[model samples]
Target chain A: MIAVLAVVQGDIGIAGLAASGILVAVAIAISLWRQLGLERSLLWASLRALVQLLFVGWVLQFVVDPDDPLIFSVIWLTAMIGFAAYTTSRRAPDVPRVLSLSIVAYAASAVVVLGVLFGFGIYDLEGRTLVPLAGMVVGNSLAATVLVSRQLLIAANEQRDLIEARLALGLTAKQAFQPHLRQALRTALVPQIESTKAVGIVFLPGAMVGLILAGVAPADAVKVQVSVMYLVLGSVATTTAVMSLGISRELFTPSQQLRRPTQRP
Target chain B: MSSLDAFELRGVDAGPAGSPILKAIDLTVPANGVTVLAGPSGAGKSTLLRLLNRLDDPLAGEIRWRDRPLIEWEPTDLRRQVAMVFQRAPIFPGSVIENLRVALPGVSDERAGHVLEHVGLDVDLLDHDAETLSGGEAQRMCVARALLTEPAVLLADEPTAALDRTARATVEDLGRSLADSGVAVIWVSHDTDQLRRLADHVIVLADGAVRATGHLDELDASDDQLVRRSVGAP
Candidate 1:
């Protein structure tokens, strides 16, 4: 199977490589436009994507050829987790207390999902499955955690008075943020749920297309795609729930008054 | 005790030592009437009103509520017992119902509606968003929210200063009604004519010092002596 893929890749050659580069550049441009509209960061993000991809291509040659795959997989997973933590924390620093919690939630949930799918029972920890599967879980959870943290923190700040008023009325901290918690969870999950609804008809997701191009039968490819989709849903849901709980509890003292930050704005 | 007296200010001095805002102030407010603290700009009337609610702790005096030192009460408990209506209504961002619910979460929708009606607000306005309300409507809503707490004392800082004549008259009527219901009202106003119309007891201040304290009717009558003595003397 590897020999056939290598021969086909070689025949396509420079044209295939050039096309992929163009596609990646276009993808980065679109991501920049959608995530940060008309900001100076868009140009920085484009340049960063180009450099990061080149660096990854350089590193992957050594990493993929390893006899002992565990070390490579562990390093890759750590890098992904660090990126996820940085992205989530940058979106919401008001809840700095939950920075480590969000990262841990992402890592633990990703490990469990990827472990179950490619664990000892299914197969030995093969790099092919571990790499792609872990990538999906980590990437999706990163996006979801960012959404949950940013939305919930903004909600808490905007309604600080209302939340404090409720606390004064004998409500526990959890009860004070119950409404915002629900809203944040919904915001985190809605995009994933909507994409799931539109998966096969509106768009052919990457996993299914990649499987077909790798010469798997269409029926078998569909099965793998469904399982991967379900895994992603579970990982994101867990990350958002855990992160909301961790972040919401950081705003108040046990005495219920706002721990007004000492630094003046 | 009973309905005769609400709050007692003893030696309440809320400013610097050389020039205190409320210089050695002493006043006992009866439990159920309007006490207008009137003076020109920079007078300590607003400062004295804030001291009544302990919003500004006096630098050098004691405020006693029902014979107990105000410092003895929990701040939140005291806030619930004594609410302040800011001069310019500070409408929180959200729906009108949510804004009203902040002061007293225990109030039922029915009770909120009743309080709104008492404050001369339209029933339909409750569903409107808070940020869209006019200044006068927002002030009325603020008063309604304060009423939801059923506070014993309501300190209104220029409650109708920003309102037109019609809205001002409407708010003054509501203030009179609140006072009639036996809530001790300390109304701060820059308008002396409005005080003459609404105040049962009048206290005039000059640059953070109480100049005179007497009944409004006596001050308006030939007893211009009190006003003349304290009007310009700091």
Candidate 2:
């Protein structure tokens, strides 16, 4: 099985990949039979993912140098943050200036968590180690930012009258939104918290499996995986706090009246 | 009389539409009295009540609280002195004591007992889940929470709308007692009987403008059919 997959990974590469197109065909056929109306999206998503991942793989061969870590990371991460900001904007398309807000929030959180880890020599500063670990942490935080921003906006909008009632009763905006902010952060953190709980017992996470597959010692892989889990969790919590607090500020005017974006316009 | 005014709205423009919920109309609420805001639906009574605490700022005029612009005061600070209860009261989750403590931390079990008494609720009810309270009980809890702050002015937006008649009377008596204690109570009620029982001064609003402002008899004597239509005719 190892020898067969090795040949498939090497000499039969393009042809081997082309044969997997059959899977997309089968999925589209199933969607058609079910009248799911998802055939177009399913096809586009599979093809787009294939092209994007292949392109990134080709680019990483040159950029993943152990000797030069800082330049590509700074450049690559700026681009990743741009895309993450756009992804977050989809969650709250009506929120004014959501792109800039998301960029600032996500980038600040990623930098702080990844920075401290590498800066303390807890993780090596090599390109291969820093880039991959930073990618995982930042990627996890992006999901948290989207969920936290969406939940905060919806919850705050729904509770405007009640929040205003508190504001009218002498609670500052900070105090008024404390409950809502906690609720939003909890919702965003649930995925990470559950994954952290389930990682070892229910399933081995991808990073641990990948490290083990690369011939690292199993004990060593376990330690790296634990570090990765904590990094991702810390990244998510920090990102959520920054974004939720910033977004909460925007939901009120200078006079402290709640401002809800009721429509896209 | 002007010196005693709790709030004075001058040429205020506010509301949901270009037409505004309240147009360029002026009104004053006398301090230490039950000023009933009487109007038909959509006539901006609630909008007026909200503006008193700067829940929203007026579009193009001034709202003065005790001779200073309402905006001059920090909104949270102003709201502390000018607290409000809603048409449907907000009962936060947790025990009733928790909800009170959210507003006034270190509020003693003793203080809770005392404040609940002001709203006519027994002290033992404080331990119940606030979310489990009956509609009237929840509303009174809101009132009790507001009174705990010792507000000089209380805004009640149809506080008894969801209550049974006995609950309505309990709330009305509470408002009366609040006014007697010199909290300048600005209340909005659509119920004509509630108005008669509670209003010390009546301000009639129609089409986002003040149609009449006077004692109930003076309101009855005024020729504005809009006032009689809002307050209900003899």
Candidate 3:
């Protein structure tokens, strides 16, 4: 565990970690001053993040070792994808087959991204690089995947008359649903695209900032950050595409009728 | 089934489970002339019209289109032969001609103009934006779009319900003319005036069941007061 702390330039001892609690204190103080009613939520979220990150950090020690079998990295990536899919389904329970569709989206994006990074020799084929890169890809794509799924469901429910009108005109479900699917995909992808466009100017991204804080040269950090940004964008696009198309298919019957989504209980 | 029948329903039950909107409905829609489905709101007139085009299916029993079971016909093919026009007249975001092209893609300008004319719309309105049309014109345009498929039957679910009096008359005339042209017009109307003017044959529905089926003259002469009142019979 100490070696894990040493992987970064300097170890943040227990005292340093406690000292960082001042930031949370400031956020809580602001919430209290504003009467925002977010004091309990802020406290709970901070504690939750601390425990979750520490657990992840402890687990990464064995897996992130370069000497460990690459299988460990693959297993870690699989678990992350599974959890992402589960979270997406939980967020959008109204979407039919969301769990399976999300799995396809996350798994496909992971393969495309990691394959490009390693196969193209952009990053070394080791658990140390593979785990973090795949983690970034999955974590970044999870929100977008959920957005695409829920957006399509919203489109189907809200524009049902329009869809049925198209269906009544003899258009197949796929043809009738194409416009809404495109709209949902656009709605899901735009946030990520805008974030990518404004990455360095508007706000420094977390990965690049973390690297710079760990004493990496700014130029080298920029190179890694640019690659990571591109991969995140690519992964988001791929995941949303898979999710929108797959969910669109599920929203219809084989007879080309749009299946009305049942109201969530 | 009579050869002149367009749709034949036997023991049909419909609507969401446990609360059917149509129940044990045995009826036949004629292959020619206007057949108005006259009922109060929630009487399942729209639901019955939806069944004719396979927009919906009965929970029980069978529907036959032109003597063939509805389940046996491909849904898209069925819809092509039996097109529907909705009440709100949902206009796709495009020109009038573009909306028509949705029913028959690659529709020529001449054919588009002809269908528009058939619906009493001006040929010049072809290039006009569909979303900008008045309520009457939009409903007429929807009728023209359905006509592009050259359907044998037109299921109009209260097609003029949202229109002003003049617009309602125009769409009513369109329905009458379409039926005169040998397209079986299955019209749903709650307006008794529209019923008196347009119903060549009437099916009166109440509480999700058929209360009467006959001509206005015969229904007016019925012993049942409800049947007489449903058709607005004097």
Q: TM-score winner between 1 and 2, please give it.
A: 2
Give candidate 1 regions above 4 Å deviation.
Answer: A1-15, A22-79, A91-138, A143-189, A227-265, B1-79, B84-113, B121-138, B155-158, B186-234
lDDT of 3 by residue, B53-160 (tens): 887778899999766899998999989888999999988888998899888999999999999999999999999999999999999999999989998888999999
Q: Where in model 2 is the C-alpha error above 4 Å?
A: A1-47, A67-69, A262-265
Model 1 residue A195 CA deviation in Å = 3.2
Among residues 3 or more apart in sequence or in different chains, the pairs in candidate 3 whose N, CA or C atoms overlap within 3 Å are none
Superior by lDDT: candidate 2 or candidate 3: 3
Question: Which CAPRI category fits model 2?
Answer: medium
Q: Score the docking of each candidate (DockQ).
A: 0.10, 0.74, 0.70
Question: Can you give the lDDT of residue A94 in candidate 2?
Answer: 61
Worst 10 residues of 2 chain B by lDDT: B1-10
Lowest-sum lDDT 10-residue window in model 3 chain A:
A1-10
The list of candidate 3 runs beyond 4 A from truth reads A1-13, A32-40, A263-265, B1-5
Report the number of the highest-lDDT candidate. 3
Q: List the residue pairs that clash in candidate 1.
A: B21-B208
Q: What is the fnat of candidate 1?
A: 0.02
Whole-model lDDT, model 3: 0.87
